[model samples]
Target chain A: MDMTFEIIGWLAGICTAVSFVPQSLKTFRTKNVAGLSALTYTVYNLGVLGWVVYGAYLKSYQMVVFNAVCFAFSFSVLAMILRYRRRSRL
Target chain B: MDMTFEIIGWLAGICTAVSFVPQSLKTFRTKNVAGLSALTYTVYNLGVLGWVVYGAYLKSYQMVVFNAVCFAFSFSVLAMILRYRRRSRL
Candidate 1:
């Protein structure tokens, strides 16, 4: 059971990380922010911050590591959106 | 610190759960899974399953509760995708 939990933890962490791939790819490929929502990503980054703090408090390396990666991914996505949004307005 | 962690945990859980909203809305409105990848979602579901087990092992209520909600949301989205894919094919 213990080993099972560890395996599950690893799978969960990896999946959660990998789940961002599609959007990342789309953003990278299209360089378009037309479909993605600014508000959503803003809240997402905030959420990531909260998660990182929470994970640190709990002393959970999995939570900290994964949320930090998510933060970086989301930040990049947000930057892309802002850049495209600005470019479109120009 | 404990209180702070609890607050952060709540925020993280809510954010993670809320993150699914845009995709759900898009899927609901467009009835289009063309942009969404089935493989991504399949892996997401598996990840959610793993998180549930890991959370249980860690005795973390936040993980179990939030992931369960996310699981339901993702399941609905997946079902919608399947239905739409079938409809589109015909």
Candidate 2:
């Protein structure tokens, strides 16, 4: 891959990875996941995991790191959603 | 790129692209975006747009197509959130 493409990929990864911050913060603060769909998040996390595997196969360190962070953020949000939902039901 | 890497990329892209469907469906069904963060969606859209640009640069048709679909889904969710927030305010 060219240097330009590599740089662009990093930029893209950073944006996507950081984008989850606000949502996670909101979920943590509000504890309101009424509009959040557990199914969608579960599927999204699977996709991120796929990226992690792909990154490992390609030996792209940046891809692996970014996707890993994204996966963590997504997983946290999912966990929070589940916790809040369970609490609501109880 | 190796065929394996390319195949993996395609699979990852498809997974991420299609993952948005359930969220979009739920949003439309409930018209409830209270748990969805407009900030996150907006930022996520930017990241997807970055992927679209990167794909164009790479001449990767699969990347372009999948990111395009993902972008549309994310944008629709953001728009719905904005609309709902406005209506709630009114």
Fraction of the real A/B interface contacts present in each candidate?
A: 0.55, 0.75
All candidates' chain B TM-scores are 0.83, 0.90
Error of 1 at B90 (Å): 5.5
Best by lDDT: 2
Q: Write the per-residue lDDT of candidate 1 for residues A1-90, one digit (tens) a residue.
A: 788778878978888767666666767787756645566578777887888898889898888898888678767778888998999899
By DockQ thresholds, what CAPRI class is model 1? Answer: medium
Give residue A9's lDDT in candidate 1 (0 to 100). Answer: 89
lDDT of 1 at A20: 61
Kindly report the interface RMSD of candidate 2, rounded to 1 decimal. Answer: 1.8
Best model number under TM-score: 2
lDDT of 1 by residue, B1-90 (tens): 688789878987888767667767767886756544465567777888788888889998878888887787777777777889999899
How does candidate 1 score on lDDT?
0.76
List per-prediction Cα lDDT, in the order shown.
Answer: 0.76, 0.87
Candidate 2 lDDT over residue span B36-65, tens digit each: 888999889989898998989889888899
